[model samples]
Target: MANKIISQRISPHLWFEHQAEEAAKFYTSIFPNSSIGRISHYTEAGHEIHGMPAGSVLTVEFTLDGQTFIALNGGPLFKFNEAISFLVNCQTQEEIDYYWDKLRAGGDPKADQCGWLKDKFGLSWQVAPVQIAEMLVDKDQERLSRVMNAVFRMKKLDLKAIEAAYGEPVGAK
Candidate 1:
């Protein structure tokens, strides 16, 4: 069989200490239209550099919500930080709560801020309502400020609270 071409222009690559497969499985389970793809193992050909067993897992390919990603067992040379994160744009409070609960499992509680959380593997994720983006970009500066303030005070975003903030009197707390 011939090689299949990847249509996506760019795909995110995650480097894990040893949980590439596990992370892939966990991520695939959380999102709709998600699935695990090809998995590749380390071979002795590059064992001198990789230092992994010949049959050890090297990489796992997975898809989440139509976006492709690759997870590699690259050891502890690097770690995930808040500098980058996956943003889940939810349409309702239920969606936000669902994603927040699922992704925040085994995550750092202290990292929960403004709808952002660091998962068990230290991956940062943002679970916020789709309207939040529109609110942020609204031409009404006062409303925008209110929405931002409300957002900053939340760990897991509450769409109702955010909407209230946006609709309240400009000077009202």
Candidate 2:
């Protein structure tokens, strides 16, 4: 068969010590329209540089919510940090709660703040309401401040609380 050209301009690549396949599977399971794509194994040809045993999983290509991603078993040379995070924009409280609960499982509870959580894989994710973007950019400074304050007070975002804050008058307790 002919080669399939990748239509995605850019794909996120995840580096894991040894759980590339596992992580891909976990993420694919959580997101709709997701699936595992390709699997590539290491060979003895580059054993010196890669250090992985021959026939070991080297990379796994997966898709999450229609976005393609590559997971590489690159060993402990690097680690995931909060410098980069995936923002999951949810349309409802249920959506936000679902993603927050699923992604935050076995994650660092302390790292959770303002809808941000570090998952079991050390990957940071922002589970937030889709309307938050508009709320933050609202023309009213007081409304924006209230919304931001509400956000700062919660780990898993509560859409109702945020909307209440947005509707509150300035200086109203």
Candidate 3:
């Protein structure tokens, strides 16, 4: 065992069968102020996996919300599922709608209220508005009930209905 290992303070590692570049581009585009760094590969690193194809971009580094992700093309022995998810604190109904529409292009959506949906790449995302926290945790049971009911009845969130249910103006204080 090597005594010196790389730093582990900042970055997530993502493994893909062959869509490393594609996924990196997709994620960087979806999130604001994000970008992908240089990508490279190794032909023979020794041991059993040696003589692997070179120039295939074995790794990639990208940033989303200033967080880094390293994508590796390690073949199809594994995959991504609902076990992990990224949450976006969307501000406008349009923002939530935008993500819901774009990310769900070839993915799936589950049951209501939680904003739990899968993106085209099988990655899960929580597309929610900033107001949901307040509505869910509100001391007024009636308001919370109304909000939950309103949420269950729709595919995409109807901000107006939620606000109406809450008896508060849209984007309330």
Off by over 4 Å in 2: 1-5, 168-173
lDDT by residue (43-138, candidate 3, tens digit) is 656426633476667877777766777888888877888788878788898898887777777786553235777776667777888888778888
- Candidate 3 wrong stretches, greater than 4 Å: 1-8, 50-52, 109-114, 169-173
Clashing pairs in 3: none
lDDT of 1 by residue, 81-152 (tens): 999999999998899989999999999999999999999999999998887776787788998898999999
Minimum summed lDDT over a 10-residue window in model 2 is located at 1-10
Best by lDDT: 2
TM-score of 2: 0.93
Model 1 ranges off by over 4 Å: 1-5, 168-173
- The C-alpha TM-scores of every prediction are 0.92, 0.93, 0.79
User: Candidate 2 on 1-173: residue-level lDDT in tens?
Assistant: 01344578898999999999999999989999998887889999978997999999998888899899989999899999999999999989899989999999888999999999999999999998888887787888998898999999998899999989899532344
Score each candidate by Cα lDDT. 0.89, 0.89, 0.75
Q: How many pairs in model 3 have backbone atoms within 3 A of each other, for residues 3 or more apart or on separate chains, i.e. clashes? A: 0
Q: Is candidate 1 or candidate 3 better by lDDT?
A: 1
RMSD of 1: 3.6
Question: What's the lDDT of the predicted structure labeled candidate 2?
Answer: 0.89
